[model samples]
Target: MTQAAIQVRDLCFQWPTGASVLQFCSLDVPKGEFWMLLGTNGSGKSTLLRLLAGLLQPQSGEIKISGQVGFVFQNPDHQLVMPTVGADVAFGLVEEKLSLAQIQARVHEALTAVNLQLLQRRPIYALSGGQKQRIAIAGAIARQCEILLLDEPTALLDPDTQLDLVAQVRNLVKSRGLTALWVTHRFDELNYCDGAFLLEQGRVVDRGAPEHLKQRLMQ
Candidate 1:
């Protein structure tokens, strides 16, 4: 639809030990829309995101992604490399060949967008789980990413904080016109997505209204 921001067509991937991870799986995430992928453990959900992010190579099929891509992991500790929040966020821009002033502006804008400007100078270890997620997302924004891929970003947060992080991501998608595809198993999180895809056995068996998928999974 409207030239998807993230397009996966007939993707196929397998491990070196002859274990199939994904097979003929395909999906399209329209530009500026927020979508979620739901699947049980070992359904290849995280593997698919990694493929789209170019972290893994596919055995077959094609993946077309428009604009810069930003990836957020389930654990912030896996990606945040800098000691301070601002440094971590700014770390993403190291290869951009930007001047100090330009990098500072980007860091400020990104932190402000995530409502983390006040904690920009705080040590990374001093932040809470939710704040850590915000910092990770801010790092993506600092790079001016147009497409965001998140792998169960709320997995470590409390119930309320989980919802808060999802809501915050939804706001970022709408406000910044960024396309986001998030991987999640939590049914309640479906309420925030424009659509949802149900993956089973490494393939998409259901895709449509989030509520419909949520209800089907419940029943």
Candidate 2:
């Protein structure tokens, strides 16, 4: 069996209002796999991602992630802070204390991995929605995160752009051997996922291959 990149055992969480938001007996994301998390609004998809990213702590049980996490929000505007593509990608590395040359190399490599090296100097405000998404991904790549936590990243994109963004993410994941937990409500997007889990009221109700889940859901 493949080693688990992320493991959650008996995890539980609640809002400040004391209302439970998530309760998972166990969950696993295998190394180098693309897993889609499907649910409607208030299903706790975003909350789960936050927990995995260490933005929130579980009230009970254990959560184990093997390596660093890079999070991408649904809106690119929320993730981006710098004025230009290159600067934005480098922003995450500034605190690493690496030499200037090392930072530049990493930024260049990350941009190239996303096929956006040419646009490194482009202004963030001038980018198309799809391009901004790519830039956001490049920042994650630059961080060299072992696992990526994406919270409904394609929610704001057009259908065609959404598909393109998924393809780009698929290529990058395969080449980098990174584990990704992506949250989305679009059933069609499951075509890009290796497997998927259905979340209902903060509980995992179903798990299987993406095609199998899609067929079952349709039926």
Candidate 3:
């Protein structure tokens, strides 16, 4: 079997208000696989994504990741902080103590990868919602993370822009061999995924190819 890029074993969690969320959830994601996570509101999809990103600690169980992980949250505002697009992409590299030359190179490469090279110097706040989300994606790519996690990445995007973003994501997975887990409520959005997991009431109730799962869901 391929070594799992991400592993969650017997995971459990709850909010401070004593609302139980995840319970005995276990999952294994292989390297370079594209996995879509589906669930209704308050069904622990976002919670599980946060746990995998190491942003939230599970109350019980073990989580292991084999490579650097990048997380793009539902809201672009939470990820983009620098005044300009260039600065935002270079932020994480600076933290890694990369030299100025190296940071600039990586930033340029990431921007070009997302087809946003021309927007590097633009003021972040002046960009449209789709542009801002692309900037966030560039920043994550600049980090050189092998695993990319996105939560409702295209929720607020127009149809055209959403398709563009999905294409970019697909390229990242194919070109960089990046492992991705996308969480969303829309089943139609998952046509690009290699496989999928269906969650109901905080547990994974089904897992299979997206087409197969869709057939089962319809039945």
For candidate 1, give the lDDT. Answer: 0.94
At residue 45, what lDDT does model 3 achieve?
91
lDDT-wise, the better of 1 and 3 is 1
Q: Which stretches of candidate 3 lie over 4 Å from their true place?
A: none
Ranking by lDDT: 1, 2, 3
Quote each prediction's TM-score. 0.98, 0.97, 0.96
Error of 3 at 22 (Å): 0.5
- Per residue, candidate 1 scores C-alpha lDDT tens digits across 1-219 of 377998899999999999998989999999999999999999999999999999999999999999999999999999899999999998999999999999999999999999999998999999999999999999999999999999999999999999999999999999999999999999899999999998898889999988799789989
Position 142, candidate 1: lDDT: 96
Ten residues in sequence with the least summed lDDT for candidate 2: 21-30
lDDT per residue for candidate 3 within 1-219, as digits (tens), equals 877898888899999999999998888888988888887888999899999988899899999999998988888988888999999999878769788899999999999988899988999989887888888878888998899899999998888888778777877888888898888767676788888888887778888888988888778
* Strongest candidate by lDDT: 1
lDDT of 2 at 53: 86
Pairs that collide, model 3: none
Ordering by TM-score: 1, 2, 3
TM-score of candidate 2 to 2 decimals:
0.97
Q: Please, what are the lDDT tens digits per residue for candidate 2 over residues 1-219?
A: 999998888788999999998886467889999898987799888988998888899889788899889898999998899999999999999879899999999999999988899998999999988889888888888988878888899999999999998878887778899999899989889999989888887678888899888987889
On TM-score, the leading prediction is 1
